[model samples]
Target: MTSQIAAGLLICLCATAWRMMRSLPAWLRLATGAVLLAGLTAAVVQMVGSPLQPVFVATGAAAVVWEQVVVAAWWLLAARLLVEVLRSTLFNRGLAAKGRLQGDLLAGLIYLAAVLTVVDTVLDLPIRALLATSGVIAIVLGLALQSTLADVFSGIAVGIERPFNIGDRVWLEGPIEGVVDQVNWRSVRIRTDGGDIATVPHSVAAKSRVINRSVPTPQRSDSVRIPCAASVPPERVAELVRHALLLSPRILAQPQPAVALVRIGRRSNEYEIGFAVASSNDLWHAKSTLLEQVLRQFRSAGVETADRPGGGATSEPDPASGSRRFLAIPLFHDIADDQRERLCRQALSRSLEPGDALFRQGDTEGSLFFVASGVMEVTRTVGARSSSLGRIGAGDYIGEIGLLTGAPHAATITALTPSDVLELRKEHLAPLLAETPHLMHAFEASARRGQALFDRRVAASVGAETVPPGQLLARIRDYFRVHHVRPGPDAHAARRHPAAQANSPPGGD
Candidate 1:
């Protein structure tokens, strides 16, 4: 009866150990299996023979085997129990949930403490003397791992300070700039915008000056400078450049752009066009665009750029480029080449700054502006709220009816970037169309198409009533005063008159 009971107990223990094998770590699983095997063998020997019996005593193999079994059960069982406790109670909590439990510093410390406890309790080993010698051992280890210790301490400091988090963009004093991808024990790994991975030692990174571009705010303030002849009025330069920058889509709309006369010399005046963008990534592009549009406007207005030291030299683009762009417009496509050329010659080129309004809703100005480059956003205001109506870019023109028919603009056109527009003002447009009656058909068709586009976007925005192209044409003719031709000379002679040129440069120059 006693032998059968020992055999039954061994079978029960083995079944329990087998059930838990998958949950154990590899070392723990081996320990558990070794311990259970020893326990089973002890139980089997107990059940198979009587102790100190004649046959059992002769060989004494069972006694030696039992001593080994006892040692294995003592150590391995303690290790398995401790491991289970550590995994279930500690690892499964907050750290495990975040997938960072493995190799965690605090957890490793806990494991060491548990191992010491098991050594003292289960092995019956007194470890107080070992604790006393630990200081000497630590000193030897410290000297061998001097660099590693520095990195570890630095990493700890970084964790506590939390200067930057994973995924934050940082520019370091070491000329390294990238987005932080991981923060490890000894180093930080970052992925640069160019797609290169950089590993920075924690000790160096901790000591370096760092700019966290992603923190506080990602918006970047930037400026573009243009040197203008001092003879040009400061107000004129500011107004022209401000309008030009308002056209850029990259620029921010608020905190309104400011132009400062930063430096003034006998030969040249330095004007800084200060503005902000939604992101630092756009800053360089925004500066490039502002410079291009501002310079183009100054050149077209005959406002010569003053040459200065360190101010990059200016290059004037081909004069024929503007005329060629003018000819590409649908309204000018049907108009005779000579008529288009005269119109282009008389047209005033304006630079528009981002968020600058070309014309407001219900504007009565009879002017057509064509987007030579950059973008324009058309918006409609109902009471105090505004909704986007549509947008236009290079090769697109706005205010056709206002230019050809003298009609009030139904929507407001705001610049989305530093933009250039060839403006055919009332003085330029009225006389041109009056002399060239055949151009009216193209004008009507173009006006209708533009109105259709406006109405289509308007319908999406507000679902308001739509206007047919015929009604749009009638409105255009009335506003342009095309019906009653106020006889003025062709655009060429009127524009060439010396008196007009003198008055023009005061504002136009």
Candidate 2:
């Protein structure tokens, strides 16, 4: 009896030590536990077979109580070892949130089986009667804890299905939208964008609609409804909204944002600007930025909003008002009003539908194009891989370098919408350059700025000295067939270029 008690104490001590050395490698800990359990079993076998067995009580059943205690302890140690092995081998490392719950449930079953075995095998009880009695008790407990059991089963189902994992951004039917923080047997914890933690139960989550935004890709599609005066053309409003979407860095360009008139009212039209962001979290910032950009674009183009206090929409700019268009251009801002009108008269208006190429890369046409209204994309192709350099919208100009330096178009310009472009050929500009001799310096400065920007955009290396101002001025004069080009007093000031300055608010870098 004393030997049996010693064996039980040895088993308990081994279990405590195994649990204490948790930082050890799992396999090594498991091996140590198996060795201890085997040693205890051997010690008990030897004690029961040897003549030196000790008796604690006179009654036969009580005399074997110590053996039963040792047997039960052995069974428990074996169950614990099996549980540890299963936990290390079959659960959690890849299972993520579902692993621990599954491990616990498995361990419970193993321990229950060990306890039943101890009752029937060690103490020699009637297994059939015991199971029959346990069946009724199980039914009673299951009914009493119906909701809890439902949660448990639902958690298992969730684990098996894996609709969303930890760290995924999800939307539940409870209107609960957030990043999954922690998932357990009872509930899933979500960290919301508003910095609040939401606990949603597995049963509720299973029954509700679950949206996993993190799967496949984190990109999220969103849109905003913009109210514009119905007086403005739908095509015009769509172009402006599309330009604003292209301007936003947070908004993705691959999907190509869309703008469409969804609703028309008595005095206003509602346009839906649909776009995508890199992640669900970026949706708000992208939307707000796009809205700001849209407002700026509308203001710049004199397009009125439906909510404008007077309820009267501003009329669109006259396409034939060349001088007014020239005044809006920063390039012609230095030209006097009368000279600008003459310059505008010499320019030719060219209209384009969407997908029309104004000029392609490597085209050496010595002409400048000014966007009267609409958006154009600038793309540069290098070794079969074409990348977008930027987008140009209303009031932006292109082909300055091609015109001034007689260089081929460094990038292709394609009309993104129904666009009105004004073309000024070198031949038409020479007489004006000869009359307004100082315009050569403005053109030189603008060309230099354009060349620098083009070089930066294409990632071309700039020499320590590119074209000198004298050489660039000579090239412009030679290209335009103009003689005796005079430098203005502000020519040196023009040399200190705002290289980073954007041509238009919607123009891309």
Candidate 3:
């Protein structure tokens, strides 16, 4: 009866081990392997008294060996289960999750300890006694694994210091620069930009200098130096540099750029333009772009570019009127020339690449945008899907509704081609509106049209009811602080009519 029960249990253990192969944990796999070996030995033991053979191993000691292996396998399975429980209840928590290598190492140690405990308790093995007797051999083995021990300790130090995470962009001394792929007990694997995986020992990683680009912040400070002729006013030179920087949409609006004359030489003045870009991913590219822009602007203004510290003097008047860009758009037609020039100076010019997002839906900034060139696609996200609103082209504007009404963007706007846009932010509008009280009315009709478009899109997107214009105008007046301006019919729909084609907003031209 004992032999039959042991045979059944052994068969069950083998089946269980086969089922556990899907698990990724090395310790669990090891324990499963041990179970398989024990089950094979137990099957032979069960056949000892059967017709297969009087004793499968032809010796009683062989049977005892099989039983001892069973004890060890059982202990290993118990340890593996305990490790799983600990992993779920504790080791998988936030901080511990960051130290996965350490967790695996600790689990491996627990598995070895379980084997030792089983040897001493069930098999009556004297583990400590053997170690004491073979102290010299133990010392020799430790010396043999010195490098391995060093790696384990070094890995622990790296984990604690955590200079970089698994996905962080890092560069080490020598040719080890890439994204960290994995951190293990003995080494780290880096996936280089070339798609090759490089495994480096933790000891080497701990000893070398590791620069983590993603840490602290990804923004980078850059400086561009250019030589300008003494003819152009320093203020005009600064303005030109600023305009060039603004043209690149990747540059952030905050931490405003600074341009200064660093050195005044006899022939030319050396100006240094210092600015921060959005990221450090392409430091060289950003520097190259700024240099190109500075040179182009200098040439267009006929400001001689000097090779060295000195500059040559040349004079060329700016042909384009300051208000030319604004006057092209019909919305600002009523503003006085001086006030229009102020708006133009306050506006920032941006060149956007095809597929770049001008603004996302639900953004609350009140900034008007004019499409100087190229086309724009407007979309509204409804639930899990998106619906197209319409397209805006040269001289057509969007975001004025949000800019004037202080409401969330009704739709997302994206560039359909390499496009140029003039952005009029709140800072540019508040002073103009506060000073010229009547100027507020210029936006009233435009605001109503924008709201109508938003309402129409909302209705078309989800079949929702249209909002009453009176209510929308009320909200608009409160947002723009234009209670004095009487509510009027929206000009957008009327302008779209055949009879009013002359008053229609400019399309792509």
Candidate with maximal TM-score: 2
Clashes of 1: 24
Best by lDDT: 2
lDDT of each: 0.63, 0.72, 0.64
Winner of 1 and 2 under TM-score: 2
How well is each residue in 1-509 modelled by candidate 3, as lDDT tens digits?
A: 47545755865765576576656675666566665555645554464442222333435676656655555555665576667656755676643645568678779899988867776765676997866868988688789999987887899999989988867778888768788888888988888877999988889999999988767886767787888876667887886677567544455667788899999876677899888876666666767766766665565555676533443455552324313654445456555555555566667788899789988877877787766555567788889999886555543566655666666776777886667777888767766555544445555654554445642343122111223344545555576564464324543332343133233332211
**Model 1 regions more than 4 Å off:** 1-103, 254-256, 307-337, 341-377, 380-386, 389-396, 399-509
Candidates 1 and 2 compared by lDDT, better number: 2
lDDT ranking from best to worst? 2, 3, 1
Please give the RMSD to the true structure for each candidate, in Å.
11.4, 8.3, 14.1
Model 2, TM vs. native: 0.63
Q: Could you tell me the lDDT of residue 461 within candidate 3? A: 25
**Model 3 ranges off by over 4 Å:** 1-20, 23-64, 86-100, 133-138, 145-148, 224-234, 260-272, 282-285, 307-311, 315-509
Backbone clash numbers for all candidates listed: 24, 1, 4
Worst 10 residues of 3 by lDDT: 458-467
